[model samples]
Target: MDSDDLGLFGPGSVTWKVHEEPILIVAGLRSLYLQSLHPRAMAGVAQNSNYRSDAWGRLVRTATYVGTTIYGTTAEAEAAGLRVRRRHARLRATDLFTGEEFRVDDPELLRWVHVTEVESFLDTARRAGLPLTADEIDGYYTEQRRSAALVGLDPATVPGTAAEVADYYRRIRPELRMTREAAETALFLTAPPIPWKLSLPARIGLNLGPPRWAYFGIAGTALALLPAWARRMYGGLGLPTTALSADLSVRALRLTLATLPRRWREGPLQQAAKERAARLAGTPA
Candidate 1:
C-alpha cells in the first residue's frame, strides 16, 4: 500500500476500538511503569528524556505520536514514524548497572517498548469493559505489527498473537529488573508535576493542596489494574490489587469518563478518522 493511502489500520480494526477509549490514559501510565523495568531502556529515558522537568509535555508528545500513527493518514503516520527514527538515530545511552552503551533504536529495546505499550492498551481496555473477544485480542496484536514496522522493527520478529506475546515475556523476564532508576521512574510516573494551568485550579479547589495526590490516586489505581505477575515485579510497591477490585475500579472509571460529551472525550484526530470512515462508507458523517 502507498504511504499516502488510508492509514495502517482501518475503522473496523481492533486498534481503533481500543485506542479510541478514554481508559488509555491509564494504559499509558501502565506501559511506562512496565517499560521502566528494563535497565537499559530506563537509562536511555533518564539520560535523554525531559520527563522530570516537563513530564506532561513529554506525555502529550508521546500521545500525539501514537494518535498520529493510529489515526492519521498513511502519509502522516509514516512521516511521524520517520521523525521518531531520525531522533533515535542521534541518541545513545549507557546501562546504569552494566556500564554498557547501546543505541536508543536498538531492535531489542524497540520491541520491549512496543510490546509493553500494545499489551497495556489491550489489557486496560479489556478490563475496562470494552467487550473485545479472544479473537479480537489476537487480531489487535496482529494489526499492531504495522505500527512496529513503522518504527523500524521487522514485523516478522514482533509478537503478533497472544501466545507469542506470552512467550516473548517469558524469554525476556531474565533481563527485567527493578533497578534504582526504575524505582525513581515509578515514583515519577505516580506523581509528576501538575501542569501550571491545572495546578492553578487544583490550588484553588483545595486551598493550595498539591494536585499530585489526585494523580497518585489514579496512578495507584492503574498500578492495581496491572496483571498479577507484572505487579509482583515491584514487590511491596504493587498496592495489593486483587482482580475483583481492579475490575470494579476499571468499570467505574470507564463509566464515569463515558459521561463526558463526545466532543469532550474524542480528540480531533479521532473525530476526523470517524468522519473519513463515514465518508468512505457512503454514510452521513
Candidate 2:
C-alpha cells in the first residue's frame, strides 16, 4: 500500500511514538506558554481568537488539527490544512507594541508558532524520560517538517535539527517579551474554566482549598518545563522553578501518566492509526 494510504506517520515513525503518549498534554501546555512570549503571535490570538471564553474549545480544535495531520489519511490531513489556511487568510491583527496591522498568515509568524510547538513536543517527551536517542530526536524534527508544510511553512526554511532549533531561539529571542496579554494567557492556562461534568466536585474541592492549590502546582510544573530563558521572560508573573525541581516533576508526572490503562491513554484516533499501520505491514490487527 502507498504510504499515504497508510497513516501519515505510520507505526515506525517517531512522530507516532511521541504523539501517542498521554504526556503530550503537558507538551501542548508548554507550547502555548512559549508561543505567548511572541507579542505579534500572541496578539493575533488575543485579538482574533476566542481563547479567553472558550479555552477548552480552542485546545480541542488544536489537538484535532494535529491529530488529523499526523494520523489521518492523506486526503483528510490535506483538507484540514486547507481549512486552517483559509481561516488564516482572512484574519488580521494589530500588534500591541508596534500598533501595525498584519495578516495572521504571515510566514514569519507562522514559523514562530511552528517551531515552538515542534520543539516543545520533542523536548517535553525527552525530559519526561521518554527513551529517544540523539538520531531519533533529529529524525522526529525532520519528520515534522511535513507537518510544518501543511500549515503554510516552508519545510526547508524551518529548523529540522536540535542545533538549528537552538539557533532559531537565539535569533528570535530579541523579539520575545512578557506583555500584559502574555501574562493573562499564562494565568488562563493555570486556572481555565472547568468542564461542566466535574464542576460540582471541582467546586467542593475549591471550597476545601486543595483543588486551587493543586491546580497552581500543576501549572507551575508546566511552566517550569520551559527553557530557562523562556521562564525568565515571565519575570515576576510567578515563582521561579529550579532546573532540578522541574526535571523531577516532569519525570514523576510521566511515570504517573504511564500507569493509566492503555484504553484510557490511547485515544480512538491513535488506536486506529496503529491498526492501519499494522494492516499496511501485513501483521495481525
Candidate 3:
C-alpha cells in the first residue's frame, strides 16, 4: 500500500496538513539513530558493488537500516521501492539472480523517507562535530538523488525545495507512534546482549561490545535529570560508544514511565523490564 493510503499525508484535513508534528520529526531522528546503531542493516545498498564510495554508501546504509527495521524484511524493503543510483554520475543498477533489472534509486515514498532520514542523520552528526569530510557530505547527496530516482521521482519533483519538503512533512507526521509490541520489540532488538549467562559464541559477541544496559538512559530521563552530569559520566567512564541499544532502551523505559504522570518510576515498561530482570535473576521484581 502507498504511504498516502496509510494516512501518512493526512487526508484533506487542514489541521493535520498544516501542523508539523513531533512524531514525524521523531520518526526521522529515530530512523537515523537506529541506522547509526545498526550500520549493517544497509547491507543491500552498501554492498551493491555497483556504487562503491562517496556519500551514497552512507546514505544507502542509513536507508537500508531504516527499511529493514521498519518493514521487517529485505524483500519487502525492495518491494517498497528502496534502492539507490547515481544522478549525473554513472549508472549503478544491478541484476538480480532471477535476471531482473534492479534500479536502486526511484522517486517513491520510501526513497523520500530514506532521503529525509539520511539528511537528518547527517545533520545530527554534523551537530555532534563528528569527523566527516566535505567530500562525504557531497557523496551523501549524490547517493540521495540516486535513491530518490529508484522509487519513481522524475528528478524534477525531487522536493529539492526546502519548503516543499517541509510541506510534505507537515502532511505526514502524525500517525507514526510505536505500538506497544513494536516498542517492546524495538527495545529488546536495540539492546546490547545481557551477560546473565551464555555460550562461547554468545560470549564472543558480548566481548565485541559492553552490555546494553550500560548505555540505555544517557539521552532520556537521565539526560534530563542531569544533563551535564550525564555527559561527564559518559566522558569519564569511557562507556561503550556502540551500545546504543542500551541507551535507547533506557530512554524508552524512562519515557514510558514518565507517561504515568503520577508515579514516574513505576510505569508499565519499567515494571515489565524489572519483572523480566527479576525472573532472570531469580529475585522479586
User: Per-residue lDDT tens digits of candidate 3, residues 1-285?
Assistant: 232121211212221221112122233334433322221222223335333223344444544444332322224434444433233123334332234444444334344455456455444333333345555554444434433544555655554443555565555434222233333334443453333353354656545333433345332322222112223322323245433433444445434434654443233322333344455567875
Measured against the true structure, the TM-scores of the candidates, in listed sequence, are 0.93, 0.92, 0.33
Quote model 3's TM-score.
0.33
Could you give candidate 2's per-residue lDDT for residues 93-184 as a string of tens digits? 99876789999999999999999999988988888888999899899989999988888888999999989999999999999998999999
Candidate 1, clashing residue pairs?
A: none
Q: In candidate 1, what residue range of length 10 has the lowest lDDT sum?
A: 205-214
RMSD of 3: 21.4
Q: Which candidate do you rate higher for TM-score, 2 or 3?
A: 2
Task: Write down the RMSD of all candidates, one decimal each.
Answer: 2.4, 2.5, 21.4
Using lDDT as the measure, the top candidate is 1
Tell how far residue 123 is off in model 2, in angstroms.
0.6
Worst 10 residues of 3 by lDDT: 14-23
Best prediction by TM-score:
1
Error of 1 at 167 (Å): 0.7
TM-score of 1: 0.93
